[model samples]
Target: MGLLAAFTHTLEITLPVFLMVFLGLGLKRLGWIDAHFITTASMLVFKVTMPALLFLSIIQADLGRALQPDLIGYFIGYTAISFFLAWAWAIWRHPRVERGIFTQGAFRANNGIVGLALAAGQYGDYGLSVGGVLAGAVIVIYNVFSVFILSLYSDEVDTDFRSLIKNLARNPLILSVVFAIPVALSGIELSGWVMTSGGYLAGMSLPLGLICIGGTLSVTAFKRSSTIALDASLWKLVWVPLFGVLGALAAGIQGPALGIIFLYLGCPGAAASFVMAKAFKSNDKLAANIIVITTFASMFTLSFGLFVLKWLDLV
Candidate 1:
């Protein structure tokens, strides 16, 4: 594809996904939704619909193709490296209390929400299948890393390993993937009614989650943005994805795999980071700012990155 064609192709994939976000923003501004709605809807998507979506996707996937050991391994290694790099930067530049928040903001991507949505947009069921399995690893790694980092800097936060493990054990998202894996591997078929019902609920997850994300975007947060927040946003939207995509190419990952990696890596800071920061008694406002800035900025960065990938026919 030529430059213009590549970009247009990219937009065709990305625009619908992002427009839901804008719709939510517009709805929120119009007094059609409030904080309570966002909070409740977020919880519903996180706990219920999203899990259903993941389970169905994984269970229906070609386990042999979807369970790419190399891709999963690369994601694990890349995430670990990125976490430590962000942590090291935070410790060097931020105060003791704020170090954890900054580090989390810098390295964590909204993979489960925005990233998965984009992946599905770009690659359809194949994307969701791969992205679903990948999300399982993401949930485990991000939670464990976030908990460890937050605990290191906060006396108020519990640092117990058992608690972390327990939380992860109960996470619906992780549990969904865990259960679906053996089923997919064993070729266990579910009833059509079950699949259909699950599909309806699953279908609601991404759009609802993206809308909540849009509603959660606060202009007030943008106004409160600090240098630290901007720095973290840069890392989230630019540096992390840049290094990650390069590493994937170096490893000979191409086509949809490389594209999926880029989309997930290029996602904005996780909304969970803000909650974790608050729980840890760190700079939550700064965390919020980073989320706002990165989320808004990613509209352009993700498009350009994907366009380049398409232009080069790498994905």
Candidate 2:
């Protein structure tokens, strides 16, 4: 009972992100922002603003305290398999263009919100940093895999290499990580003024991102697609969590690593799920529902997963 309460406590803290998501959806219903706004907002968060956030965080990280082999191994086992498995599932769902849409539910996740919230609760900033690295790697892999999946599901035999190149070129997170790698090696510190301003800007990135997300949750997407959402809930909410847990354990991670994996595994599907759906012109409805449901469902699994961790005294 005590264990369950601890899990729920953490979950309640994390639930606000969904409310923020709904806030975005509500704003969209009122026609305050549209798809173009979502694109713009996502771009801002992904490229310039959020990259600054990652660079600052990663830069300040105590490298000696960071970098655990078990954590890396766990994420490798958990995220890699899920990344590929999602593609295989979508490919097999052929003829149903909705498969690509549902695939986003499978492949994408609410890592930033759910994972960070839980990581902070469990491992504090240390755990969060570990989770962040894993999340970063997974995001890169996910981008690559999702593109390939879209090609197969879209049945595009001659996918333009230019498109892939452009994506990598424009991605802020990737660029920030690349930039940080060199700076991390250099071991230089940012000026006080720069740190102060960057910190302010970085703070704005997520809350603004959430508010924008809240503004763009489409009513049309909700009303239009039912079956696609059902499929998403089934696989993303249930199957993915199951697979992620077993895979993490099988890969020989425990303690902080295991806790971090559970936090990530318990994340609701990504808010970006809609992006993949629209890009492929697949089941946008299902993708949205999958995002919504998995997010809500995470309140349960996250709590349960956290409870398990608490019982094991990992935190």
Maximum-TM-score candidate? 1
Model 2 RMSD in Å is 3.1
- Steric clash pairs (candidate 1): none
Pick by lDDT: which candidate is best? 1
**Residue range 1-315, candidate 1, lDDT tens digits:** 799899899999889888999999999999999999999999999999999999999988888879999999999899999999999998888787778888899999999989999999999889999999998888889999998998888888778899889999999999999999998888888999999999999999999999999999999989888988988889898999999999999999999999999999999889999898888887788889999999999999999999999999999
Candidate 2 — worst ten consecutive residues by lDDT sum? 216-225
How does residue 241 of candidate 2 score in lDDT? 68
- Tens-place lDDT per residue, model 2, 208-260, is 67766566555455555476576666676667766776666666656677767
Clashes of 2: 7
Error of 1 at 283 (Å): 1.0
Task: Note the residue pairs that clash in candidate 2.
Answer: 23-214, 24-214, 24-215, 24-216, 25-214, 25-217, 109-270
